[model samples]
Target: MTIILKEVLESEKPILRNLYSLYLHELSNFTMNLNLGEDGAFHYEELDDFWRVDGLSPYFITLNEKTIGFILLLERPFLKKSNDYGINDFFILNQYKGKGLAVQAARKIFEEKPGQYFIIQVVENKRAVAFWKKVYTGLNIETNERQDLIDKELCLIQTFKV
Candidate 1:
């Protein structure tokens, strides 16, 4: 399977919105405490914000021409000390889990968005931690782990340089 990261554009908002809805829904139900109400999910308002920001990028993850997931990379001034770039959001459909596809997608992000990067995962989300751990270790990348509160919830923040 060929995994690719395509820069999401304004005309592709429909596709991004659909994926974002699913991503937020799954995360809310499985990992985070956020509630998803009837056919609607959070993150609708932030759709355009990414395009407006200079440091934020939205990429669509595709495998063999099929859209499966997305990665949101942001450049923050500071996090856990020095890293400027962050993996703000990453999600693969339930059908696409356990195949190391995400690792490849992440590796692509590491390549395309080169710099001292960080990915923050909720501490309660063991799957996320494991996934990020695999991506970091499989790529032979060095990581510095830290703990920080995001939205009043503690999160495991992993920082690395690529």
Candidate 2:
């Protein structure tokens, strides 16, 4: 299973939008704020900002040439912090979970874009917290972790350099 991280293009925004809808639906299980719009679609107002914003990136995670997930990368000036980058959003289709694909994709991104980084996981999302813990351990990277409230949800924030 060769994994590829392809930068999303303007013409392919719709594809990402569709995938994001599914991602949001899945996330609704862990958070209460997500809802379908009047158009019956999950709206992500900032989806287009990836193209317009200087430091935002949208990458489609493809395996064997099929898109299975996506990663939203936030960098430098885009974020109001000294950290080099942040993983704004990451999702793999439910069908693709539990096969170590997420970890490999994450590792690939971190390896390619080496710098100070931070990751946040809602405290209620045990799987995501464990996933990040596993990634940190597997890579043997030291991490600084703390609990914080974000959007009224308690979240575990991990900071480290890659």
Candidate 3:
């Protein structure tokens, strides 16, 4: 399948909101083993809050113009270095998992806009740890860990030095 990753347009907010709700619900269910009440109604208000923030560049993963998933790429100042950039909030729909779409999308992002270092955070939960291990091992990435605010949660930061 030809998956297209494109910048989200303002007019597509409604559809993107619905897709994001599905993405969040699936992610919560996968990690927490329970849905965090990410129904359409609950997400509608949340999406409104998200849009209010500036510098949030959300993208849509589409197959023939139909959005199947979404990812938010935010360029923010790094805590380690004030001049560096960070990418945050990446998610894909559960139905589209195991398709290698994320790797392709990430490659496209780097190709279009290169960075000195690309970092992604993985939670310390069992599933996330396993997933990140595969990704890091496949990509030969180096990682470090730090304590997160939540108990039993750690910030597994993997960096791609380019």
Candidate 4:
């Protein structure tokens, strides 16, 4: 499959917002921070900052001209001093998993953004850790890993340079 990372435009923020709700729901499986709003939908307040803030990017991962997932990339002063860039959020529709599409999409993003990178998986989400490990190994990149706490939740972080 041909993977494309299309930079999200300001006018497309609503589309991204919808997909982000799905991403947050998936994330809720491992983190306790998710809660439904009065509208019975998940919400991400800082999502709008991707457009307003410098170095924060939101992209739609497309295949065959259709959006299959979304990726949020963070860079520079927005993150901790350890890495220059970070994969802030990534999600592929459930139907698309295990076909190597995610791996391809991730590789494409790494190619587009070459620098020291940071990726984290909630420690409770073993599948996420495995997925990142596969992506790193497939890219032939070595990583420095450690455990860290964010919002009182334990997470596994991998740092690497491309």
Query: Candidate 1's residue-wise lDDT over 1-162, tens digit each?
Result: 779998899899999998988887767744555666575565656788878767678899999989899988887632345777888999899899888899889888888778888788888788888988988789999999999988877899887899
The predictions' CA RMSDs to the true structure, in order, are 2.4, 1.0, 4.0, 1.1
Please provide TM-scores, in order, for all candidate models, with all chains considered together: 0.89, 0.96, 0.68, 0.96
lDDT tens readout by residue for model 4, 14-96: 99988988888888898778997788778999988998888898899999999989999998767768688999888999999
Regions of candidate 1 where Cα sits further than 4 Å from its true position: 30-33, 37-39, 76-81
| lDDT assessment of candidate 3 | 0.58
lDDT of 2 at 30: 87
Instruction: Give candidate 4's total backbone clashes.
Output: 0
Kindly report the root-mean-square deviation of model 4 from the true structure over all alpha carbons.
1.1
What lDDT does candidate 3 reach at residue 120? 49
- By lDDT, the better pick of 1 and 2 is 2
Error of 3 at 36 (Å): 5.6
Which residue pairs clash within candidate 4? Answer: none
- In model 4, the worst 10-residue window by lDDT is 75-84
Query: Where does candidate 3 stray beyond 4 Å?
Result: 30-40, 44-54, 76-84, 116-125, 150-153
* Highest lDDT scorer: 2
Error of 4 at 149 (Å): 0.9
> Sort by TM-score, best first: what order?
2, 4, 1, 3
Scored by lDDT, model 4 comes in at: 0.90
